[model samples]
Target chain A: MDRSKLHSVIALDMVEFEFNGTPHKSPPQTTVAGLLESLGIEYRFCAVEVNEEILPKAQYSIYEVKPGDRIEVVTLVGGG
Target chain B: MSTNIHRLSVAGKLLESRVIVGTGKYETLDVMRESLDASGTSCVTVAVRREKLYDRDGKNLLDYIDLKRYTLLPNTAGCFNAKDAVRVARMGREILSDLGNPGADWVKLEVLGDTKTLLPDPVATLEACQRLVEDGFKVLCYTSDCPIMAVRLKSAGAASVMPAASPIGSGQGILNPNNLKIILEYLKSDDPDYPVIIDAGVGTASDVAEVFELGADGVLLNTAIAHARDPIMMASAVRNSAIAGRQAYLAGRIPKRLYAMASSPEEGVITSRPW
Candidate 1:
C-alpha cells in the first residue's frame, strides 16, 4: 500500500475522545483500564467517569471507550 | 469528665476526636500529613477532582493519608448544584468503597450558591442532602449559620449539620454567634445527641475553642491550621483548644450579670475596698 493510503487506514482505526477536558486519541475499543494504563495511572487508585456518568471500577476492564466520549478520571484532592 | 471519653457520634459513626481537620491548603503533602497527625483528628475532609496525569511527580494524596488511621470524609467542595453535588458524592463513595474504607457511606456535602462567598445554597444543599440520604449516604451538610436552614437540613435527614462560622476560607471566624447558638438550641432540643459541627471560617486556635464553647458537637476547619505559619504547631494548638473548650462547656461558666461578682468571699473584706 502507498504511504498516504496506509496513514489514512491507520487514522480510521483510531478513536478521538476527551480525557479530563483534553483531547486524546486511542485505538477503538480501548477499555478504561487500557486508557489508564496508557497514562501511567493505576485503575484502582482513581474513579472514572464516561460522559459525566461514573464508571464503576469493576467495569474498568470491560467498559470500552467510543469516539467523542468524554472520560474524566478523578481522585482525592486537598480541599476545605 | 474528660473530653477524651466523650466521643462525637454522627449517624452511628463515633469519632474519637471532636476536631475534624480538612487535608487542604498546606504548602506540601508532607506538611499536610504531619499536620493531620498533629491535629489528632479521627476524620479528615478531602475533595474529589480530576486527576493530574502525565506529571513528573506521581504522588497521590492517599499515599500520605493512612486509611487505617483517618476516616476520609470526601467533600463535594466545588459543586454548585444538587445534581453535580450528588454525582460527586457518588464518585467519592465509589473511590472509598473500593479501598474498603468506612467513609464510603458518608459524604461532606457542599453546594455553593456563589463562587465569591463559597456559601452554600440553602435550596440546593437541602435538595442534595435529601437525595444523598435517599441513596443511603450519611450526609454531613454544610451551610451558612442560618438557624432555619440548619433546621431544614436536619429535617431532610442529614447525619450532621455543619454551619459555617463565616464564608469559606475567609478566616474571619464565627461571624454570627447568636445564630449559631440558636442552631444549637433548635437542633439539640429534640435529639440532644445530634451532631452539629461548626465548619469553616476558623482563623486560629481560639476560633476552635469558641466553637466548642458554644456547645457545638465538633469543629471542622482547614485554613486555620493548614495555612498557619507553622502548620503542625497550629494543628496541635487547635487540637488542645478543642479539648479545652469542650471541657469548659461541660464545666459550665457562671451566668452573665451586670455587676461584678467577686471570686473571693465577701466576709473576708479586709483587702477589698471598692469606691
Candidate 2:
C-alpha cells in the first residue's frame, strides 16, 4: 500500500523487450551480461550498446537492463 | 631494369606488397588462406559486421588469418552513416588491440549509400574520414573515382584515398581509367607518392594490370578471386599481373601520336634505292 512497496511490485511484474531488433522477454534478475550469456553470445569479440549509447565492456557485469532498452550488439564478421 | 621492390607505404607503414586483398566471399578458411598466400598481398581487408559464434574453439574468421604474416586491414564496409562508420572503426581498433596487435590501427572507411548501387556517400565518407583521422586513427577511405572527392579525402588526412574502378563486386574492371588517371594525377601532383589505391570492381588479372598501368599505387578486391572458379590460381594470376603492370609503368610507355614515327633512326635505315 506504501509508495516504495508499490514501486517494487511494479518492477517485479516487468516483462518483454527488444534486442538487436527482435522482441525479447526479460527473466527475473537479468543483467546485460546475463542476457548475453544466456543467448550464448560471446562478449570478447563484440561490443554492446544500450539505448544508442555504447557501454564499455567492463560495465557489462553491472549494467542492468530496463524493460524498454534497445540493445545493439555488434561484432566483426567476414565482409568486404 | 628496375628490380626495386615496390612497397605500399601508407600511414607511415611500409608494406612489402602493394596489392591489398579482401578476406570475404571465400568458400572456406583453407581456401581463403591459400588464395591469400597466392595473391602475394602483404595486407588483407576484413569487414566489420555482427556474426553469430556458438563454437567454443574460438574458430572465427580472424583466427584463419595469420596476423603475424599479413597486415589485417579492418574495414567499415556496410556503414551508411558517419557515426556508424566511426563506431565500427573504433570497435575494429579495439578488437585488433585485444587480439595482441596493438599497433594495428589502420581503418578502411567505406560509407556506402543506396544498397542497390553500393556506392559511397561522398559527404558521409569525408565526414567519417575527418573524424577518424582526428581520433588518431589511420584512415584509408574508399571514395568514388572522382578527382575532387579523392582530393578532398586526402585533404581530410586519409592515409590512402581509394577510388573504385567501377562499383563494389560489379566485376566491371577499370570502367573508367580516365577518371582513375585524373584522381592519380590530382593527388600525386602535390605529393608524387601519395597512395591512391583502386578499391573495387576488378574482374581479372588483366583488370588488375590495367589499373596498375593507369598508375594507381595499389588495388583492392574481394569477389574477383573469391568468386572465381579457381580462387588460388586466379589469385596467382592477379599477383603476376599486378607486378607486370607496375613494371611496365615504371619502364616508360611509348607516346601516342597522330602519325606513325619510326622507332629506328632514319639515317641508320638503308634507303630502297641504295646509294
Candidate 3:
C-alpha cells in the first residue's frame, strides 16, 4: 500500500465529505473539529456522529478521525 | 335540550378545537405566530433536535412560540429507534422544564423505519410509546394507516394514535381513507376512550375537513398551512373547515348512495317519462 496516497473517507450521513488534502496521511491524526476547520466549514447547527457513536459537542475537539469511518452530521432546519 | 358535543381531551386538557398546527415552514416567526393564533389551535406540535439548542447568543426557536397561547407537543421527528426516541423525549422534557414550561408533557412519538417515505416503524413506535407513557409522558404516537396497529398502539397506553393520511409531506390527501375510517371506527367502538388524531398527508382545507368528517378526534398538519401562498389565510380556512367537519359529524351525516332519490311526491306530481 502507498502510504502517501492513502486517505480516510469521512462519510456524512451516507454522503462522502472526503478529506484528502492532508500531507501527513498516517490516519490524519486530526480531531473532527479540526477536520471540519481544515475544510473551511463550521458547525453551524449540527450534531456529529462517528462510527454510529454520537459525538458530544464538547468532545468534538478530543475525538480523532479514522479511515473507513462513517460520520453523520445532522443539521436541524424546521419541521413538525 | 341537546347535549353538548364532546371534544378530545389529553392529560386533563380539553382540546375543543381538533386542528393541531405545527410551528414550522412559515417565512417568519411573526407569520407563524399569527397563523397559529388565527387557526385557533389549542395544541401545536414541534420537532426537537440537538442542534436547535445551539442558537446565536440567546435566540432560540422555543422563544418564538408562546407557551400560554397553545399547549406544546414536542415530537421525535428524526429518531429511527426506540432508544433514540427515549433520549429525544428526555431532552425535550429537560428543555421544557428549564423554560419554566412544565406542562409540556405531551410528546408526538415518531420512529421512522425508512427515510424515503418517512413511514413509522410500528414495532419501535409501540415500544417507545410504552416507555414514554410509563415515564409519565403523554404519548401521541405517529403510526401507519393500519387499524390493527392503531388498536395495538391504543392498547399499549398511547394518549392518542395519529395515523398518517399518506406518506409524510407527500400531500397525497388521504391515500387510505377506508383504513383511516376503519381505525376511527375500531377505536370508537372497541375502546371508545382513545383519541384518534389524523396526522400527515393533508394538502389543503378540504383534506382537513375529510379527516375530521371521518370521525377523527383531531388533525395534525404542517405543510398544508405553513407552505401555502397565504399561510395565515389558509390557516384560518383550515381551522374553519375542521370545525365545520366536527360539527357536521356531530350533527350526523346521511349515508352515501349510488342512486339519486326522488324528492317530489309520487302521488300528487305527474312527470313525463320516455318509456
Docking class of 3: incorrect
Ranking of all predicted structures according to lDDT, beginning with the best and ending with the worst: 1, 2, 3
Write model 1 residue lDDT over B174-231, tens digit each, in one string: 8999999999999999798889999999999999989998999999999988889999
Cα RMSD to the true fold for all candidates: 1.8, 4.7, 8.1
Ranking by DockQ: 1, 2, 3
Q: In model 1, which runs have C-alpha deviations exceeding 4 angstroms?
A: B1-6, B268-275
Error of 1 at B10 (Å): 1.2
Q: Can you tell me which runs of candidate 3 are displaced by over 4 Å?
A: A1-78, B1-6, B51-58, B98-103, B270-275
Candidate 1 residue pairs that clash: none
What does the lDDT come to for candidate 1?
0.90
- Best candidate according to TM-score: 1
Error of 3 at B106 (Å): 1.4
Summing lDDT over every window of 10 consecutive residues in candidate 3 chain B, give the lowest-scoring window: B50-59
For each candidate, what is chain B's TM-score? 0.95, 0.91, 0.91
Task: Specify the highest-DockQ model's number.
Answer: 1
